[model samples]
Target: MHNDCIFAIQLYFMQPVTGFSKLSKSQKIDWLVTNHLNDNATARETLTQYWNEDQKLQDLHDGFSENTVTNYYFPFGLAPNFKIDGQLVTIPMAIEESSVVAAASKAAKFWMDRGGFKTVIKGTKKVGQVHLMYHGLSSEMDAFYAFAKAELLQSLEQINASMKKRGGGIVSLDLIDKTKNLKGYYQLHATFETKDAMGANFINTTLEQLATTFRLKASQFDGFSSDVPEVIMSILSNYVPECVVNVSVSCKIDEIGTINGVTGKEFARKFVQAVDIATVEPYRAVTHNKGIMNGIDAVVIATGNDFRAVEAGVHAYAARDGQYRSLTKARVENDTFIFEADFPLALGTVGGLTSLHPLSKLALQILENPSAEHLMKVTAVAGLAQNFAALHSLVTTGIQAGHMKMHLVNMLEQIGATDVEKDLLRKEYADKTPSFSALRESLLVLRS
Candidate 1:
């Protein structure tokens, strides 16, 4: 009896509570505050402060995920005057980075009269895999594939019916041999065209069904009646090399004109040299790609697409030649300064949070309700423009000059400056470099 009581006590401490996942949203929050937080009342107040005031809207947000935590917000801003393929597009970007929107807007304006950005959608193919293990002979494995290929395609007819109506579904299936890498290992590789959806769930569901059908059919096939292939797992691949978009901005070297005290010819030459360094140096390429993602991810989040997937595919594409290199390329030919980026981006326009989240819906509307292809083009242009702007600053007045100027506002806020004090400091730092420590010391001197 004593031992039983001790065991129960140990279990209670090891596991916080029973049926935590099944708890009501309010009950979960109550439990969290009561047990986890240092100050329960203050925690409760802070959490509730972030909630939407409208009851219906709060409920909608609560349904987005488990635990019903308070919303975390980012600044949603617009970079106007982006002309892509001769059409003007004002991009919506949701990000916490201070200078991304400003940089993108500046790039757009710089190129608006210099022939803007151009984009092309190369392909739109997503992928999934069904892993399997077969200890049988190679001949048997080949025979099994021959038999299973037809059955797998026939089995998914019902599943593919609706997708087919929308001009998408399974595009092709292949049996991949991996016996050299891992003993008794194989994969059923499948490619899909999901149209306007990101299609992770769809691809996963289809792969699972295919695995099931393969196992059932193998039990009845002559070669596998006794030893059937072991079903390992099924999943969707985020590294979508087939789904690619290319964006480029080009202008005559003389048309680059002058900006930030750098002549057009000097700027173009330095820009191409910078890109060449990134192409050869891994250390520089990572930062170069990160700058591009700053623009890509912002638009991806605002439009409710999966930014992580886009990031994975883009980075993989960058390293496709076995060396990690810059996604953006720049060159000069016949007095034309050309900057271009070709990367895989499997984004969606009509599914997931696009239909659910209020801001996502508004973001799509702001883009004028683009199709999946159009969204791909817009996202690519944003990335290319951001890289161009960053390089432009780097080759001219240096990055920190303008960046720190914008960052001065954040530093002032951090130092508890009032509107009048901030106005005074802005004038004081107008011609000087701004730093947090310097700003704080200046504010103290002024107050004293």
Candidate 2:
């Protein structure tokens, strides 16, 4: 009965048209032919228009005047069949490459057939830093903290009032004195529970407010000599202090055997090994980190998170071992492939063009109004799933087979293969090989 229930879940989510996993090369050709000849043109056009409208809105918000590099249009595809923890979710991703959406979708389907992915998220706390660079206050550090404590607390209270109604708010503050490079620099750390928002802009803005109040109070003090210390950088720490999200998945061997030669558990083990290599060595870590970012960057583009900030934080964290490491780790345990990804994700929820980009706003809405913390947790899970898909392909079929087949379309186009010629060549080369030399030879023969 448990097995039957699992089957039903898989059927509901994946809804794959093909029942048998194996097919002749001719059969695959035929399938492609049917999709091209009989596909829904009107539906495709509608989607194109939707994305165009989104692009226009993005342009307006970003202030693109035609010569700017701000407008980016990546391929937006939906991973249609995902049942994570018994809940169906259609993940929307904007990426330029092929295979990723399909790979993740198929993996999610396999997990669904076995048992589906389960997830947990830890408590949410955001950290903000205040740099106090005042001369001669080094000796009076204790007095300085005391002088600024009440007003800072009051500032947090006002910030928390709105948050308190939403079931979260500013919780605590920490202070540190003295720095090596910058003499007479004191740091006051503010830890706030940002709830679902990424709380970056929120936390930074709040810290700026407190810093202003502290500066005013410091001027009135007798021992304080430095000009109301101007805040150099006020922003939330990416090292999220709150407990983040956790997810786990299990898939049966028979279920995975449907796809190819290896068992699900074996694939899981190889994936773990690959990720482990990335964690320990810089040589493999670059590609491993790329795979993690492949997932994260797509999601960030979709939801309008500062992808650059995410990239910066992740790459910085990767180099923590004096060398870079993979942002994700994978393992096999108890008939399951366990994957985890944690890095500094300094995302903001409300501020900037997040409110400006219409499609970005739509992307956020599709995610069910996720808070900043919730978004990070979900981001981690998505990265894990994507990493698994990439490594599994690497270990099993050797990643290039499917990838190159898709690239053939581009290679043909690059050599100036027309639509008709491309389709004919693709059909002729059913084995999925791009014979550019052959095409050139054929062109010469036809001229003769």
Candidate 3:
């Protein structure tokens, strides 16, 4: 217990500084390991190279597989002060984006001043779908679903021996009849609690075997081609998945007011209005969702889950309402701003890169083997923070006010401008309308 406490404290203080270039490789690695549990010397040594990996990274000419290249995870940090339902929690995120981490952290701090975040995580259940297309079986759809459910359960008992031992088995089968459409498709949704694992890979393998076994059992004399010809896709469906995590944050208006002239209530109302833009417009929602993912993807990679899978599911879920919109809802009521975000989080406790990645294993240790529900809880908080940061920036100043200035310095330096020359250009471009010719002339004047 003492060691765990010490490690936890160490994790809090080991947060990376804002300006990353100042830190030595060893220092960065130490920070990564202390906070994330997944840092190593190799990651530290190649940190700069990793930053450039997206570009200059060439195809592996020799023996390395495509998986090797795509699987290299980037860890970014989001440190936010938060009190979740009076329980103080510091969120450490690993993402790769310009403003995502900062935005989320700021948002967390804002909500902490009120009453903090409150979350309720449902059971970590995943749904895998088995779709079969039958050609000449207009009347067989009903019978086929019934037989498939029993066979699927039996297969679940055989293959998911571990789940059964742990008192978890295939719970039920939900049949979706979309026969009015082309080819008359049948979707069998297998719902089950996976205990700890994400269960996609395991479930996929099980479903594939079950589909073949069930077809054979239905018609033992010959192949069941005419009746149930082929299985279109026997895998997981991100649609209406059972795995969900719901999180909400409530804080008084006074908690949001930092400006001397502005009351907290007024600030909260303005912030609410800013977030509403994302809810109403798809254009704003895209970037808004991206900011949320910035924090999510980092943790996903750090924990060795399938980030791409989660991303695909989230965007699709966003459009599920017929109109593309925000995944989160925010409002200012009474003296408090209430925020809630819920999404399909099909994260597993084991398998995939979770076992393969060295850093992912270490990061998981930092969270103390959090359940899927707990992980989703953290993700919800992070998303809230990200949304807060974005709205705060846009509402107060403007999108590019700070970011553009920083980028300009980088641009000036890249163009061989000395510190003195860069300073001159920054002053000249403060209006943000400097011509290339004017910049070139200024550079010449500075050199002289």
Q: Which candidate number has the best lDDT?
A: 1
Off by over 4 Å in 2: 1-59, 62-71, 134-139, 156-160, 178-182, 224-231, 239-243, 252-259, 263-266, 319-323, 334-337, 343-354, 368-374, 433-448
Encode model 2's per-residue lDDT on 33-134: one tens digit a residue: 344323445544443344334655645844633323224467777775666657676666778877766766766666667666666655556677888776
Please count the clashing residue pairs in each candidate, in the order shown. 0, 5, 6
lDDT of 1 by residue, 1-448 (tens): 6955765565567555888888876687787775566335888888878989898999998888877768888999999999899999999999998899999999999999989999888899999999999887867888889977888999999888888899999999998989999998999999999998888878998999999999888887887633788989999999988998999989899998897888999999999999999999999999999999999999999999999888988998899999999999999999999999897888888878988999999999999998888999999989998999899899998999889998888889899999999999999999998998899899999999
Candidate 2 backbone collisions, by pair = 196-371, 196-372, 197-371, 197-372, 198-372
For candidate 3, write residues 101-120 as lDDT tens digits: 66666667766666777887
For candidate 3, report its TM-score: 0.75
The 10-residue segment of model 1 with minimum total lDDT is 7-16
Residue 401, candidate 1: Cα error in Å is 1.3
Q: Which candidate is the best by TM-score?
A: 1
Q: Which stretches of candidate 1 lie over 4 Å from their true place?
A: 1-15, 24-26, 224-226
Evaluated at residue 343, the lDDT of candidate 2 is: 53
